[model samples]
Target: MKTLYETSLKESLAIQKRVIGALLMREIITRYGRNNLGFLWLFVEPLMLTLLIVFLWKFLRADRISSLNIVAFILTGYPMAMMWRNASNRAIGAISANVSLLYHRNVRVLDTIISRTLLEVAGATIAQIAIMAVLIAIRWVDVPNDIFYMLLAWLLMALFAFGLGLIICSIAFKFDAFGKIWSTLSFILLPLSGAFFFVSSLPIQAQKYVLWIPMIHGTEMFRHGYFGSSVITMENPWYLLLCDLVLLFVGLAMVAGFSKGVEAR
Candidate 1:
């Protein structure tokens, strides 16, 4: 029995691996092929944005917000935002976008969403890491204080994204108008995500409010991993983890319920 179970697990993993690679390739071309720079822009995009934000903040504010380096602040914030926003936004339309592919026996709708999210999130992450490396090379930022926390933060961020995506996709599948609503919601959360500022600097009431949102903690945890725990407030990791878990299950339940409607058409 153990051997049979192990064999099935291996086969499933192999299939998932194939799906991951194929989707990554397809996404690279279809998503970036039109641009002259192509995948190189993967590095260029985050670098430019981080530089721009840091420059603007420098000129506008005229001093560092905290002991943290200005460049590092922008660098961390952008990719964390990108991970959450892109993953959830892309996922919101995953089912409808791939509905045509659903006709193909081999293209499972869930795989399509997961693959696309992974490709996008992975590309953005690599680009962010590369930017961090270059900045550190020039002494723009410090080395990652804890590689484990950095990775753990990324995992939590990805899970939070995937979990939220599942819920959004479920809603969008039922109400086509939800696509617009999702975009609107992104704008609302953009400032609240604390991409530029440290969580400690916020008003006490605001910190309490933001703490309830998992992405805030996810971003702070990630920054803490890199800059040391001083960068983010010492919030309860389990609380954020619990929120992530609850939202994840909610997303899964929504997807399960809406999946039948997906097949009816």
Candidate 2:
């Protein structure tokens, strides 16, 4: 027989799971509609973006920095970055967009943000797997040397993205202007994320500074798995894990503080 506290906790968890699932379905239909591609666009959107970047880099980047396959390099790096970037970006205005739903006692601001972030992460993950499969089939890219490591890296990045979305969603709720400019600020920060370049490629002094950015660590760890012993990488899984924990703590606190004032008009 479960204690009353345990029973209540279990019921809360079940309700939250159901609420998030419903929010996810609503988001998919609202964003994509029931037209042609519809919910397929969840993966297709990221898939197309990754393909365009891969092709553009393959053709236009006249200089070859490494002997590694360019397609493989970008494929491994960009989609992972996109997972976090797009997730955090969509988190802006999440409360406002789904404010009406919050009128329901069980629906919450966190649920809205989580649903959006999860959708972006899911889309990017699916796109990365599908593209890797197609490229491997055609011999355009080699099989990853350590797939488990890649999965771990991807999972860490997704957690980081979720935490980031929560923080960004909290901030955006408080400041409408900040929400508007985050896209631009995030764009400026994207290159520094190590999406397009290897951390080992930087000067020894620069590498230390670049590694301070949490996103770079995930990118490096991911590429490390894909390239194996062929390349050098600098990624401290503990450091990124620490950042994820801090972000989640601060984000949840902020959300709890602000959500009270967010009445549905």
The lDDT leader among the candidates is 2
* Residues forming the 10-long window of minimal summed lDDT in candidate 2: 60-69
- Judged by whole-model lDDT over C-alpha atoms, candidate 2 comes out at 0.86
- What is the RMSD, in Å, between candidate 1 and the native fold over all Cα? 2.6
Q: Which stretches of candidate 2 lie over 4 Å from their true place?
A: 35-65
lDDT of 2 by residue, 1-265 (tens): 8999999999999999999999999888888876757657656665676678767766877438546687787788777877888899999968878999988999988889989999888888887888789889999889899999999999999999999999888888778888778888888988888999998888998988988899999999999998998998989999999999999999999989988888876
- Which is the leading candidate under TM-score? 2
> What are the TM-scores, per candidate, against the unseen true structure?
0.87, 0.92
lDDT comparing candidate 1 with the true structure:
0.76
lDDT of each: 0.76, 0.86
